[model samples]
Target: MTVLHQLRRALLKPPSFTQAYGGTRTLTSPYHTENNSTAFIKPDDQNNRKTQGKWLTLPPFNTTINGASLGKNIAGIRQSTGEGNESTTTAIKWVMRCCPQLPRSLVQKLFRLRQVRRKPLESSNSVGDVHASECQVKRVSAKDSMRFGDTVYLPITVEASPTEKTECLCTEEELKFLHDLELYKDSAIIVINKPTGMPVQGGIGIKRSLDELAGTYMRYELSEAPRLVHRLDRDSSGILVLGRTQYSATVLHSIFREKTIGASNIDLKSEKRFLQRKYWALVIGSPRRPQGLISVPLGKVVMDDGRSERITVVENVSTTASQHAITEYRVLDSSFHGLTWLELSPLTGRKHQLRVHCAEVLGTPIVGDYKYGWQAHKKWNRIQIASSNLEHKIEVCNKSSLPFGLNLESGSIADKQPNLHLHCKKMVLPDVSSAIKQACISSSDYDFADIKSLKFDAPLPPHMQRSWDILSS
Candidate 1:
């Protein structure tokens, strides 16, 4: 009998495999073909089969065998195509979706073992030999991109059910909330008005960080999760950008890094990719000058406890530990009641750069920034200037006469210790999606002007709005 017939007979009488193995070895497990059931070979049988070094050339499947489904078969050959929403998915991710119970390592092992296969991209139905090596058992990589309509073949099915699930940590309500936060979206990027108190990335005790939430729910329809391009403080609310694809993420990361390092050399109008971030902060006191730039080199200094760190203006700029930090500030509106609204634009990105410059360099501390401005807050309480009527010579605070932090109508105390008033109000950057495609065709010939710069503005958060209302009045 042929090898195919011998294998068929062996599968039919699994317990009596002595006829096939010449009574040297015995079959311990029957091949399962159910979708949920695992189709795998036992360890001894696998070793025996490997020693025999026999390759089974399966014909194009017409019907089920041993109740084996097309997609699920333990020992039976099968073909699966990349279908549904994914335009292009990695081989590893596709395998994980097909077999949820299979561990990532085992899926990778299947690829490494040449058990998984795919038809060559340039193959055709009218090609020469019927049993030609069109779908050879090669070492398929996990990162290999599987385009839509691509058929993947498997000679043997792997075990399932004993592996841990890889599911998103976010609940349905959290996902809905994140969906609402999306300010702008395209194939390449996603911009969100990040809420205060929600961290960009997870930490020691942070359960639901924005990055994790975005990666889970903010996929929209893309194959990969959106990745954070920049960072915003946990207590600050503002426009945060995310990249949907690997190429987009790399482009954005490089742009931000270049801007931070060589801010002075960059020409905004000429360089279309040049990124700009405008911030609006409410500070305790006004700057000495109405508008000017603060060029200070900042360094991280360890506090007395040795566990905590603080970013402070360093006297020596030449040190490797210190980075040159520059911020341009303009007093938008100032009130006699010890509050000033300042518009800030940072030329260089440094940790706590704006906060340190506002508090130390400008002698004005941002309102509600307790970490860097606690001393200023303790020195000044919210003084109610009762005399509403003011001369034009002095800046008149004109608006509703509502008191700060206390609602007289509701008799409820507002957020006493409000979040940081620093907000990333606006962002101007290149259209990354179009830019990427344009570069792919001919980068040298590509003109940056072909794509318009994207401008986004985020409104003030509730606490800041409330504070602004109280200050304006």
Candidate 2:
């Protein structure tokens, strides 16, 4: 036959175990068909044809191997390889490369298992043998077998533990109240319209709080009871978020701290914020400008009475334990009764930020805010008495020590005290539906369809509603 024809026949011939590695012994694999076998050719093996051992593929098995099952197989392989002096790390690497579906957990498990198995064996072995075994295991762990860079291919079937699930001890009435207060609910988060006088978290004298109520009442069929992601003042009524899972809490907390609202002129619009909180307040007066931004630094100050602490605008920005607080306000409506309905949006979440800004910066204090607005009200009353005619000063009584219009007879008291008029009216949160869906795709416990975008508005509380009604009338 011609040399060209012989070369052509050699090229066309199907690859056999003997043809590939000049051997009669065959390496069997389940992936192979009757006609063809997959060959793994190592660069070192190609050069050193005289090597004693041939690369062996995994034995054929009837059952399919998943991530956890593969972990067991890897443990066995690592244990066996550690016993022998031969370098099987290259073979394990080839197996991992070929079967990309194997999980990274398997690799870690293999190392851990090998170390554990080697410990007992090494205790009884000669010093030389223990040293050799340690060298081999360390070499495999350091360089060849454990390099699973970034991606991890875990099986869709994850084991769910019964211990992970939790139950709450709340009454039926509390559950109903929670249901009524709910603004939004999903697999990941629950947003509730918290009422004034209810603390977000428990304090020294606070017997009940939104957190306790949430733990009791918001236990929708989840592995654990929902947890609060952020806090609102005890007197501030508004939208509050609770994470249904630890993962959700972590994610939401990070998002709230990092994200921003409304796009800037720069490319910052592309990086959207996760949380947007808008508040409504009935202030005693209007701002000089109809709408404006307040960028002030605020710090905590202890009053002379030593019973309470309040946040005030810092004059000396250079030296103080102060944080930058920014708030945007717009006059929604104004009344002849010396009250203005203002929509306040805070860029930074400082304690009593909105109240301090209105009282100090804008020369307008929020109505029903005793801490900030009470002093302003007394001053205004004195000014009015001095300026007004005798007809206006006809009736004045100190029957109750409370502020002029804050008598119990007035229907403005929501709880025991005259409630703060500030309300968290609206909140905009990022849509985490896709993430929830992905997380729940393999989970039979949670229904993925229940997860959705978090955008909700809470109705004004009773006191604020009453004040609004009076102002509108």
Candidate 3:
């Protein structure tokens, strides 16, 4: 059978909920009715219906009358009784007594009968109960810069941008793109908004990355180029952080490595503080706008078969030796554009953490993800770069029949999907020592065309550029 068929068979297995576990062990979501009785009527489940559907719509937990919230819902029950117009003294009083935690904005939405209410915040990394520490406010001067020393904060943003303006970096002639730099300080960190279709780092068999752009920008500005502190998947787009000084790199690296707050960890305040990382990806299907926190434990799947790419997640191995992983997400927008714009925040660092969590646990696989429970490779070949294209080079002489069509002599084959889809859009942090802060850079924006000129695409062979252009566009 085909790889997609195999994947479907693997992922869509019917739940055997009743075969072994029976009545008392029925699986439940954050707000299951069986747990809370008042507002939730446990539909005549007397005889125990054995069969059920695989997918689930969000549960209802809020109640309202007329146009106001009677109260919040939890464990399948409304906190207060619903009454006329849900606005006057009675409704408000009930809510005040039983559901004081229901904020006014949320109460209004519920009263208006909006969809997709927030689920419980019981998970370790959920909005409530953050156990991380806080740091004091700090700043650094250009003189104390990492290029100078970690004694000061490094400024990353180099230009200003119109608030709420989403740059459409992908153009008709270009499928791959980069962001316009707003403020690029000589030290600290630099932020570049990457466009879809470009790799953040190389080695998809060999390709260009934002790494190559630093040198070009340095030449134009006659300043030092920044170094990449974190990474974004090639097919995705958005903002990225790069360090310009060794001290900045060392400091930022420590935060991420240790999972420290402001370094890359969540603390008591739920501030989402860190050398924080966030992203906006266009996912698949019509999903809940603000949904997703895959708390499944994850472990890497290594292969002894010598395949260069790892499988990321082992199949059907939940509740095993995997490390805990939390991926928070909210849908920004969606359509048959065959994509859903998403704001993703990863709580724990794991290899392929977000990608695997999105697919296996959350059930919303990224649009162009080829591995980790998607279809396996349909065709394969070595991606090519010239002797001059690569800073380091070696001959890729093919010794056997190629799986996909190939000249074997010439090196020019892109990976499946042509372009990967995963981007690093924004990052947040609270108490970073100004000594390592890259977020301190000023903010400025650049034109789409100007951002494109920073790469070495001019020397790309015509056929390769044409294909690159086609895939990117």
Using lDDT as the yardstick, the better of models 1 and 2 is 1
Count of backbone clashes, every candidate in sequence: 1, 1, 34
Q: Can you write out model 3's per-residue Cα lDDT over 1-473, one digit (the tens) per residue?
A: 25334433433343322221222212122222221211112235536644322211122223222111111110011223332313232332222222322334433333233211122212213211223100211221112211111111101110011222122233432322223333333334565665445466656564345676453343222223345766766544556656553334443455555452222234434642333466555445445446756566566554767665452444456554556666778886654334456667786667777777666765566645667535422322223534354322223555354312222223223322433345564555322223212112311111111111111111222223333333333
Q: What are the lDDT scores of the predictions, listed in order?
A: 0.60, 0.53, 0.38
Task: Sort every candidate by lDDT, greatest first.
Answer: 1, 2, 3
Off by over 4 Å in 1: 1-173, 267-273, 385-415
Candidate whose lDDT is highest: 1
Question: In the order shown, what is each candidate's alpha-carbon RMSD?
Answer: 14.7, 21.0, 27.8
- State model 3's lDDT: 0.38
TM-score, one value per model = 0.64, 0.55, 0.40
Candidate 1 residue-wise lDDT, 1-473, digit = tens: 25435433433332211121222222222112211111222345454453331222212211111111211111112224322211245666555544434556656655665455544534525223234433332335778876533334433323212344245565565556668778998867889998777789989987668887776667654435567878999878899999875446655776677667677665544534357899999898888899998888899999999999999989876764898888889999988887899999898889998999999999998887888899998887665433343222123232243221112121000244656888999999767766655534442333445466789999987667756666665
Q: Comparing candidate 2 with candidate 3, which one achieves the higher TM-score? A: 2
In model 2, how large is the Cα lDDT of residue 235? 73
After best superposition, candidate 2 residue 359: deviation in angstroms?
A: 0.7
